[model samples]
Target: MTTVLPDLRPGGGRSQQAVGMPELLQVIWHETRTSRAAIHRARPDTRCDLRISASAPDRELIGTILLDGDCACRDLLVDMLVECDRHLSDRAGLLGNPLGAARVHVRKKAVHDWIRRRRTEVGAQARVDRIRTSALALGLPDEFHRALLEYLADEAGVMAPLDSEDALHRRLATRCAAEFGGAAEHYRARVAAGMTLVERHCRSGTRVNAGTAAEPDKVTWWERYIERPMGRRPRRTDKPLVTAAPECGDGTHQPPEPASADAADFDAQVVAVLVAALRRQPVTPDAALRAGLDDLVSQGLLPQRCAIELCSDCNRFALAAKELSALR
Candidate 1:
């Protein structure tokens, strides 16, 4: 799935990268201008409430654009965000001020408590980069040519490993099936093959095993889920997205039930196979994020019901102040 992201100026690193929220908002708004209004007219289902405001505010206008704007531009702005939360750990080891680790942890959590659409995008990008690299090294022939690993870069976590436990993994697989108009298993197998190649290479080289995972005190991603961003990506914007999903902490929500027993069973089997395969591979960031979730579950630190419930309440909120176009 070569996605071919809209000319989001993927090479746009000069002035845009350094700009703050206000400027970034203006830039994307400018870029998405014409397409925004057209889409509102094109998609009558959006029920867009068009109101002209001469002095409303750029923030509110951006929110309206993102809520009902073109998907391509919306995706591009998501990619353009800079991940700025300095980390205390990654796939490497403990980093930053260890003496102030607790304080830093709190501060980082505070950052996460803000908009996280960018960080989530970063995670998906990270998965694509590493997995794509591993795919090349293993001579998998253009990734055995798995799905091109590009679409997810624009959307959500579509590049996730087939067997991994991230929320969007199955969503990608399902979409792949729909896009190709069937051959569901073939698409699923491509995803699995990408992960399998990583496992194969790691088993053949120096790597970490489950023993290091045997820590009695619950090591957490502190050992495994380090971010180690090369250059910070996806910085937070000052405002939140007014159209973002509800947060997980709310009590009046419910976890999404599976469409059927068969679908649920299929997802469970995929996870089981993926867990077994990855144990033979290295605990890189991809391994850690996916496998770490499993460890948390097995240790009873994160129960299945709790994890499922959070998905319903929605851990997927974007900044109220993000992305392009439509003005009415």
Candidate 2:
């Protein structure tokens, strides 16, 4: 008897001889991860020293190396330190210190405090910008936008004395729906988006009160009526009916084309695969693109024939996952 060995090439198993593009992508991803892990293990705890310099108004500094594993923070500290030094030298005798050494300490502390305050203000402004952008995207009115900013700034009290921002937003959205006659769901979505923006900004750093600006455009009373629910209009029987004759010429009307079952099944399969992949691992852009595709292919949900179209769809899903992750 002659001994025969099985072909062990990519996708050469008994199931299917040709590998799908998604499976090939998975192989590449696995190899890439293995290589990265090996490289990380080979050179773990590697230290890097960086030197940064900037030109000041009246300062001549050669260079300084910052160490502490956070080069960006160190660079910022050095810049702030140099700025304080310049301020001290400029106001040598103005601060009642002839040698400028005694007041240097005080001036340094003031400079650092100023920087902290400025950073807080900038972060607050960023949060306000995000809230405004979200409101604009939701098509919220100018009055509602200002109210949201005020709420974020803690300038207004909640209706039911709620402790959390979420509760406050819910109450405010309900009030907005009642007052504006707009869709409650739309207002709730806008409020949620605004609250999320403020919460994310607060979590990142110290919270500061956001300044409120005048509304960009004024809404007239007539414009407000547009948001209100409109009554059904009466039907008119003025036009005569005009139906086209059958084009087949046999006097038999051809039936309308039915919806594609294959397309619907493909979409449902794609969603199922994405949900399974996300549940397996937290959805990230990289993980969704590679591992998600791998999961779909391995689970036999994605067909080899539809690999190319599915790959494009997977890319879109990956981008959406990234945006959702960022919001979280």
lDDT of 1 by residue, 1-328 (tens): 1122121222223322222333333444454445455444434444444322223245444422232334433443333322211221221133323223323433344223322444343332333445445533444455333343333332333221222223234554666777666765566666555545433443444333213346633322111122112111222111211222445686443433443369666566545544553454433333323343444344434445554333222112111001100100
Model 1 Cα shift for residue 97 (angstroms)? 44
Model 1 ranges off by over 4 Å: 1-27, 33-122, 126-136, 139-142, 145-328
Q: In candidate 2, what are the lDDT values of residues 22-132, reduced to their tens digit?
A: 333233333234333432443334332433322223333222222233423333333434443444445443443322332344334643454344434322221233444
10 residues in a row with least lDDT, candidate 2? 226-235
Which residues of candidate 2, in runs, are more than 4 Å off? 1-67, 71-76, 93-95, 98-147, 150-276, 281-319, 322-328
Q: Give the C-alpha miss distance for residue 175 in model 1, angstroms.
A: 8.6
Model 1 quality (TM-score): 0.27
- C-alpha RMSD by candidate, in order: 19.0, 26.0
All models: lDDT? 0.35, 0.40
Question: Could you estimate the TM-score for every candidate?
Answer: 0.27, 0.26
Q: How accurate is candidate 1 locally (lDDT)?
A: 0.35
After aligning candidate 2 to the native by TM-score, how far in Å is the CA of 62 from where it should be? 14
